[model samples]
Target: MFFDLALVFLCIAAVSQFLYFLLITSNHKDFVKRYNRDFKEFRPKVLLTVPCKGLDMGFFRNILSLMRLDYENYNIHFVVESESDPAYESLQRIIDRCRDDMPAGFAKVLVAGISKGYSQKNHNLLHSLRFAPHDTEIYAFADSDTRVSRLWLAHLMYPLRNSKYGVSTGYRYFIPARRRFSNLALSSMNAAAAQIMGKSKYTTQVWGGSMAIRKELFEQLNVANLWQKSISDDLTLSAAVRNAGYKIRLMPRCFTVTFEDMSWGQLFEFGRRQMLITRVAYLRMWLWGLFCLLNHFLGVWILPVAAAVRFAMGENDAKLFAAAAVIHWASLIYRTYMRRRTFEFVLGPYGGYVRQLSMWEFLLNPLWLALMLALILISSFGRTICWRGVRYRLNGAFDIERLNR
Candidate 1:
């Protein structure tokens, strides 16, 4: 009787979760259409700060995509730790070739020197902000590794026109560099994360990779003061904005693409670092994420396990377990399909570039789920993480001790 009740409960949860996914996915599609139709033409003077550490995969291509942005009247400031950093020369070459076509003072690389208290990326961004032209209206930030669309800046900046929106952010969608198991698995895991973002204030956190804020509000909130001792830029900023009673706007059309090829070792390191950062910087979201992960694991596995146990006991209700498994799996698969369709619409032309990504994301969902659960579990204990060869011990959200460079 207990087993029967549990199976019924699992099936009900699976169906309810599917319905929830359907609602979010449908809302995302509608958001994409509405944003493109209504918010495509807001251009303001902007300062785009991109912090660089090392040569990431497709570094040159990613930098070139930024140079080719469709927006007008914006300056790109690429900041590195020092002139000796490998990415510095690469940025210079790209600037040399493209500066002629851009407006005068279009792109330049600045040296931030070594970080003293906080992350080097944070130091670099703070250094770059010091040079923001007084006329700059919007302060935009991008990561060095992701490739953005031509309209990325325009789309990212539009929502900030409203005073109620504190930050405008976009998430990354990884495209596998090779059709290998680990790369595809990482992409699928990341895709699952990217799908969860929408208009939900509870779920939306600012992603520093592709986020922007109004210059006036940025100074008013004193976000740089918050980042001065912080290891994380986005999470710190997210908390500040939320505390000020402002909403974060997640732009569906502004999702950036990253090309990646990770071995299993590299994948775990990356995933663990990300979750660990979230664990320390934003514990509430981390707890919420853990709940979702547990919910998903139980919703999918309870029936199969129940069915196997019943079959081993030679019980008749084993057939009932099998039927519940079919409904649960089918609902999950259809939800996955609808989510992918929503992403295709969000990505627009770039959708064609991600060949076989949907298939891999669907086929490898179970593996990624297990891997992600393991990552979150592992992150729950760690306070130290190494990012771009710099190791730091996170004492708390606002206290960071640099262990090494």
Candidate 2:
């Protein structure tokens, strides 16, 4: 009786996940339609701030993509914690080489010095804001490792023209620099997170890698003061926006691409750091994610084990459990394929790369989920996280203790 009951619950969860996947698919289709609408005349004086630490994969190409944005009336402020950081020198070289070919605005590197209490990325961003021109209307943030399309700025800022939206966010999609197991595994895991993002309020969160907020809303919410000691800019800002009774619009066209090649250790560290941050700052979201992880874990791992045991016992309903396992795995792979299609619609230039990634995801999603479950379980017990070689203890969402600068 217990076995039968468990199987019933598993089937319900599987159907629910599939329905949720369908909902996100519909939301993505709406997002694609929004991408076709023109926003050429809605240019706002924007400040694009990217905080850098080390030299990421394809760092030069990523920075160059920022310099080549097709928008007008915007400036790129690349900030590093110190001049000693490798990215600082690279930023200088890129600006020097691409000055004549840049768009309407200028690109310059700023040194934010060392962080005292907050994460270095937040410190760099807040420091650069101090130097932003008084006339700047919108503040945009991107990560150093991401390569964006020329229309990234245009699409990210366009939604803010409506007063109801508090912030606009774009997520990152990973492309493996090499087709190795670890590289493909990390990309597949990252894609699983990215696939959940869409136009719905419940599903949208501020992604600092590609997000924009108007200056008026920024000051009204006192985001600068809010971010003073927070470890995560994107998650904290997401909370602030929602608390202030504002909506975050997910912009599909602004999805940034990241080319990555990670070893197994690096992959584990990256995954753990992200889960730890979410666990510390966003408990409810973390709990929901944990619930989803466990559901997927059980469906893929536990269900198969139960099926094998029943089969060995020569049970009559063994085929039912076996069929459920196949359905769950199929749902995961089908959803991944659907998500890749949505990405290819906007990031058209990387169509081949996204296609290749989908193949890896189909093959490795079960293993990826298992690794993700392990990362989530491990992260549940830690408050300290290391990001970009800096270790800090998270006291709460806003309180932080930096162990090293």
Q: Tens digit of lDDT per residue, candidate 1, span 1-405? A: 895677667666665665676577566667766776434567889999999988999999899888878777799899999999999998999898887786524788999999987899999999999999989999999999999988888889888988899999999988888888998888888877777686567777899999999988999999988899899999999999999999999997789988888998989888999999998889999998887787677657777887789899998888777776776677678767866777777777777645457777777687778888889999988788889999999998889999986
| Model 1 residue 21 lDDT score | 63
**TM-score for each predicted model, relative to the true structure:** 0.93, 0.94
Clashes of 2: 0
In order, what is each prediction's RMSD in angstroms?
2.3, 2.0
- Name the 10 consecutive residues with the lowest summed lDDT in model 2: 30-39
- Candidate 2, position 143, lDDT: 96
Residue pair clashes in candidate 2: none
| Candidate 2 TM-score, true structure as reference | 0.94
- Measured on C-alpha atoms, candidate 1 has an lDDT of 0.84
Output the TM-score of candidate 1: 0.93
